[model samples]
Structure formats: structure tokens, C-alpha cells
Target: MIKHIVFWRLNDTAYGNNKQTNADILKEKILAMQPKIDGLIKIEAGFDFSGEKDSCDVVLYSEFTNKDALHRYQIHPDHLEIKKWLAEVR
Candidate 1:
């Protein structure tokens, strides 16, 4: 299995919502991928509860069957769409 993890320190406000709300939105989007993509064995997103100034706002953890699966997920159109929105918010 291959694991991919990502952390994001979102803007204080984006998409007309606060950081925590945006985290919720991101988590929903990321988790929604489980049934939509192939070779994605497992996936989850997390919120930062540390309440520390330096902590990230959200996190994504994913598992793939192998390198090919990971690569496909990286280039998949659905993920690309999310990546675009993510760039703007982050």
C-alpha cells in the first residue's frame, strides 16, 4: 500500500466562509472521492484541533494500491478540479 498525506493552512476566510468552515468543506470534498475513483483503497481528511497558531487547518490522508494507482489519482480529472479550488483557497 502507498500512503499520501497532505496538510493545508487555509486562509482565514475563503469561498465566503471562515477557516474552520472551509476545512469542513474540504474534508467533505476529499472524502467524497472514495467511491468516485479507482485504486483508492482508503481516504480520510482531518481537522486541526491543536488551537495553535502554527498548526494547519486541515489534512488529507490517502492510500493507494501502488504507484500506478497513486499516479492515476494525481492526474484524475475529478481530483484536478478540486486541486484548482484548493489552490485558490489556500
Candidate 2:
């Protein structure tokens, strides 16, 4: 199995949305991709409540059957959409 993890810190204000709000929306969009990608064993994302200065606003944890699955996921259209939106926010 292969695991893919990501951490994101949103801008205080971007695309007219607050950091927390954008985190929530982005979380939902990322979690929604689990069913659409092949070989994606599992995927989840959420906001951080730690409040630590070093803590990021959002986190993504995903598991795939193998390295190839992980590669496929990177270019998957659904994921690309989220990546594009995140670029605007970050």
C-alpha cells in the first residue's frame, strides 16, 4: 500500500472566504474524490483544532493500493480540480 499525506495552511482571506471556511470547503471537495478514483483505497481530509502555530489549517491522508495508484491519483481530473482551486486560495 501507499500512503499520501498533505498539509495546507490557507490564507487569512482568499477568494472572498475566510481561512476556516475555505478549509472546510476544501476538505469536503477532497474527501468527495474517494469514490471516483481507481485504486484509491481510502481518503480523508479535515481541519486542525490544535491551534499550534506550526499546525496547518487542513490535512489530507490517503491510501492507495500501490505506487501506480498514487500516481494516477495525482493527475486524476477530480483531484486536479481541487488542486486548481487550492492554488487560488493559497
Candidate 3:
């Protein structure tokens, strides 16, 4: 399996939502994707509670059967939607 990991840092207020709120919403969105996607061995998403300025607001950890599955997941329409929203927020 291949491991895919990502870290995100949101602006203090993005798309009219506060950082924590936006992170929470995004976390839920990401976690919800596991069941819909194919070839995913495992997936996890969460926010940092470390109270450190250098910490990323959110982190995603995923395992895929192969690189192709990872690639497919990256370009999947639903994934793209979230990625676009995240781009706007970041």
C-alpha cells in the first residue's frame, strides 16, 4: 500500500469562516470521502490541538492499494471540489 499525507493551514478567516470552523468543516468533508472512493485501504483526517503557531490546521492520512488509486482519488470530482475550496481558503 502507498501512504498519502497532506497538511493544510488556513487563513485566520477564509471564505467568511474562522480558521477553526473552516478546518472543522473541511475535516468532516474529507473524512466522509473514505466510503465513497475506491481502492482506499484506510483514511483519516483531523485538526491539530497542539496550540502551536507552527502547526498546520488540518492533516489527512490515507492509504491506497497503489499509486493509481491515489491518483484517481486526487482527481476524482468530489476530491477536486474539496481541493478547490481548500485552495480558496488557503
What Cα-based lDDT does every candidate model obtain? 0.90, 0.91, 0.89
Report the Cα lDDT for residue 41, model 2: 97
What tens digits encode model 1's per-residue C-alpha lDDT throughout 1-90? 999999898998888998888888888889888987789999999998989999988889999999989998999888998899898789
**lDDT of candidate 3 over 57-78, digit per residue (tens):** 8899999999999988998888
Better by TM-score, candidate 2 or 1:
1
lDDT of 2 at 32: 88
Top candidate (TM-score):
1
Alpha-carbon TM-score of each model against the true structure:
0.95, 0.94, 0.93
In candidate 3, residue 5 scores what lDDT?
94
Where does candidate 1 have its weakest 10-residue lDDT segment? 29-38
Rank candidates by TM-score, best first: 1, 2, 3
Q: What is the model-wide C-alpha lDDT for candidate 3? A: 0.89
What candidate 3 gets wrong by more than 4 Å, as runs, is none
Candidates arranged by lDDT, highest first: 2, 1, 3
**Candidates 2 and 3: which is better by lDDT?**
2
